[model samples]
Target: MTTEAKICQGPHTGGQGPSSLDELVARVAACGARPRIALAACAEAHALGALLDAMERGIAQPLLVGDMDQTARIAAELGRDISGIAAVHAPDPREAVQCAVDMVRRGEADVLMKGLVNTDVLLRRVLNRATGLPPKGVLSHVAVFELPASGGTTRLAMMTDAAVNIRPNLQRKLEIVHNAVAVARALGIARPRVAMLAATEKVILPAMPATLDAQIVARMAEQGEFGEADVAGPMALDIALSPDAAARKGVDHPVAGCADILVAPDIESGNILYKSLTILARADMASTMAGSSAPLVVTSRGDSERSKFCSIALAGYLALAARS
Candidate 1:
């Protein structure tokens, strides 16, 4: 049977959403459709390895746009066969990125993955007004983390704008929240709880600008601006995740302790928190650019093969969900 035929035969539950990365992959496996991924400048070993793994697991169908000889060499070095995969030769990195972006814009690909090219190069092509993927308002990065809880369990949490939109203003933050909530909903969180992070839980004028923005966002949430999502702001990091800390701090809000999403005040704090969770706490994460025409996988070069594969799974699932 053909790959598409086999995928169409997979079972569909349309039931509970995934709570962990493993479950997320399983959900994608059960989606009965494979998202077509276009990898820009796909000469990198780690990125190719992850895409190969994803293809083997039926999570993605990859279209490689790069130096085909280098891709074949890397695949051979990794002892993986790429005979069945499609390739578009664009030896120049910029050309490769533009080709990949054009594929997405033309609906030839469902997802976009960054490969050997620099991020700015890839993003510049993607943000090109005429030949790029048009933004749904603004482009932002959302990192989904599977963190270890108190017991021997793990929970999924999302952090936003860690890699994009440095120093976003109030309006931009609102757009970021909307982008994140869309991702959370795509992941099956019916009503995500959002925590706007700040140094303290108090809005001190002239000192903490983040607190002011957070307070305004929280009020907007109360006014039904963010749809079904629950949002709170001016929450310290400890109060955002720890119920015990919330209790001790006397923070009586719906999203104080159990926030499904954390919105950072700036890129520095967001990137630090994201890296801390990955490097210090040893959390597993999958990240993608939200608010794009299609799901975009932009994992860091320092990220593991597992991280890249999981990112493909996340993006694949989102692509399938968007189709549904």
Candidate 2:
């Protein structure tokens, strides 16, 4: 969301990048156990297809929670075989969401994946006060992307409350950071460096409270607020991405160059930035709602097959990593 300088890579006008799906899948496979995942609204064509693919690859053991008859019909239409798959029938989407969440609460499923259901409906069950997977306020959305130019190593970036919190205050941002850091640790990142993004590197007057919040977050981290994570901020996007840009601008932050995570100011900026990267830049990404008792894969139905597959792997990774 920062008005930072545009980042340009060699010969690629639109964004060029390596997908993290393959890498994540490989990691899951190496764990030697197929993680159990529950699918909400599992009857959709894309949803069933992706679940089948994940099952066949041994990355996930899916507990399909939706209209079983409709799931079968969709699978049949999609030329998928549901012979060995286990499913729990829920006639309505709202019930389906609760079924999936219930599986997680009961330890029947390790992760939660949303299919054709509206995110709001599914989230209502997840955020239910008396009965839910985790506490009400801890849920946040995290997207992990691998840049093509960067090769091999996976880069972790986080945007908070993209699908949930509209405009978070300063205290809420701390929770967001904590949630993001937990996700980073799940991805095997040790001591992740968090860069709080703003429109500029310096905190300006009356323009962006985010800049000041970034500074405050950094100080909080210094005071042992966030364990094992280094936080720095009020940085523009370019400064976060390009080490050279930070040096040229006389910035001296640990996360200036090679930042592992970029925390956006608000939902508007975070959502817009994510969409820009996916639509305009052509970034291959997978997102999930995390910080709950179970990971929730909440990719849109419009997402590509690759995106869905990556999200499945991500959910499985978190599930497996949690065990370790």
Candidate 3:
């Protein structure tokens, strides 16, 4: 059986994600691939650094779209050599996004990454039905996290639509879950445990829209909508993550204390959860835009190079999966 199949069927259900970014990188290496990535507006240090690292590690082959001269200068400043890195000059940031997006559409690139360009501009191309990257479902942000081992197993946690979907309704949430589950499957989690996050565990009608929606979504999962994944919902953040909290609250769920995916209530709560983990909890995260035919690496300015590289690795793994 493949790793994913084993994950879904393996007797050990002690919840394991990757222990470190090293594991993700190792998975990419196992694919024996260097995914071609078209990075738009490649003028920022963070983005370029990430690309350089990925290239060095042989995880990605980058096609830089930006001012070639400026990108070369920045590379020199960063103490890196881009003598062999393929690049194109778009003369402007927006046009650079166009160039990168066009590369993906042309099959010259397996992945599209955002560099120095504004997110709105990059997204305009990504969401453009005529020219944008096509997602498998709805475009949603899937941020992967490698949590510390809680019992000799490193748990991988994923949060969805943290930076993309705004106020996702029931249908949109379903799409978001599918999108995230696709990502989880890419990461070798066959039957990922999904927890639909809400304010509380109560399924009060009309009073808690999120809870009600989550309840229905869990039922849909029970109906085998999300493959072999275990889906639970109408639970608070703490109840979803902390077994101790779940027990204190008398909540016993297979997904509780071991959720692979956390379906946020909305973008507000999703963003807050994502930021809290990164900024305060000192978590390492890899975020990418999924639901497309191609994976898009998206990161924050405040993100570390490791995070950005993780995003690249995430995209690489997904791209490899699609090809396979």
Candidate number of the best TM-score:
1
TM-score of each model, in listed order: 0.94, 0.89, 0.91
lDDT of 3: 0.83
Tens-digit per-residue lDDT, 194-214, candidate 1: 999999999989989999999
On a 0 to 100 scale, what is the lDDT of residue 237 in model 1?
90
Model 2: ten consecutive residues of lowest lDDT? 1-10
Q: Between prediction 1 and prediction 3, which has the larger lDDT? A: 1
Ranking according to lDDT, highest score first: 1, 3, 2
> How large is the C-alpha RMSD of every model relative to the true structure?
2.7, 8.6, 4.3
Instruction: Kindly list the per-residue Cα lDDT of model 2 for residues 135-248, writing each as its tens digit.
Output: 435677888776543545555455555566677788888888888888777766667789888898778867778889999999999998988878988888888778789899
Residue 194 miss distance in model 1 (angstroms)? 0.3
If both were scored by TM-score, which would come out higher, candidate 1 or candidate 3? 1
- Give the best candidate by lDDT: 1
Q: In candidate 3, what residue range of length 10 has the lowest lDDT sum?
A: 5-14
Superposed Cα deviation of residue 288, candidate 1 (Å): 0.5
- Reference-based lDDT, each prediction: 0.87, 0.76, 0.83
Clashing pairs in 3: 17-156, 134-292, 134-293, 135-291, 135-292, 136-291
Descending-TM-score candidate ranking: 1, 3, 2
